[model samples]
Target: MRILNTIESALSGFLFLLGIVISLYSVFMRYVLGASQSWATEVYTMLLVWAIFIGFSTALKEDKHIAIEFLYDKSGPTMKKVSQVIVFIIGIGFSLFIIWTGFNMVLTAYSQQIKTIDLGFPIWINYLIMPIAGILLFIRFCEKAYKYFVKHEEVTHGGDVEWKQ
Candidate 1:
């Protein structure tokens, strides 16, 4: 589990850095060189997508995702546990929905040979990030659920409140 978290974090960071580099190069080429590669926009868009989706997994692992903690804190431990369970279940459902929709979107793009406006690069390749990240997020949610219920541990929310998850 720890290994998975580390891998996700590293991958997210790498993708983010790659996106920044690509975007910087694109800007430099367009302004400094007075010209830009036709594929720069496509590449940057894909990189940004990958960074956001992969970063989601990292956020989940670190419990950095935003939540309204005021109410959860006021509740008792049992209520906190219940809230965590509900939240985890909802998160799993949402991830599954994203995976399903993303899969279909990618499939359609691949089937139609979708391409970028200027570069003609395969669009499905970019869309693939959605499902991959969805799966990662789903796994992370399941891991949290296991730790919450089976282990009966409380999740510390930095100093705000202890969530029984």
Candidate 2:
């Protein structure tokens, strides 16, 4: 699992850097070189989506996603555990939904011969990220739930987080 997490992180980091570089290059080309690109928009958008989906798994592992902290902060340990369980269940549910719908979407795109407007790339290739990331997120959620419920531990990326401590 740790190895998988590391790989996911590496992919996410690569995508982040590539997306920024491409976006910057696109901007420079548009404003500095005076050559408007027809494909830049589509490329950047796809990069952004891919980065986001890939990053989602690491974000869950790091516990960086948004939560209602006000109530959680004041709650007791039992309440906190309960909340975490609930959140984990919700996350699992959503991830499953994404996996199912994403598979359907890819099939639909493939069957219909859908393509990106600017580059004409097969749309299913882009939609493939959804199910892949969804599975990753679901596994992370299950891991978290196991730690919280079975091991009775608080899994956090930052042991020095002042608020959590």
Residue pairs in clash, model 2: none
Give Cα-based local distance difference scores for all models: 0.83, 0.84
> Lowest lDDT 10-mer window, candidate 2?
156-165
* lDDT digits (tens) for residues 1-165 of candidate 2: 989988998888888788788888889999999988868878877888898898998888887887677888788978977887788889999999999999999999999999999899999999999999999999989988887667657754343222333
CA error at residue 95 for candidate 2, angstroms = 0.8
Which candidate leads the pack in TM-score?
Answer: 1
Error of 1 at 140 (Å): 0.5
Q: lDDT for model 2, on a 0 to 1 scale?
A: 0.84
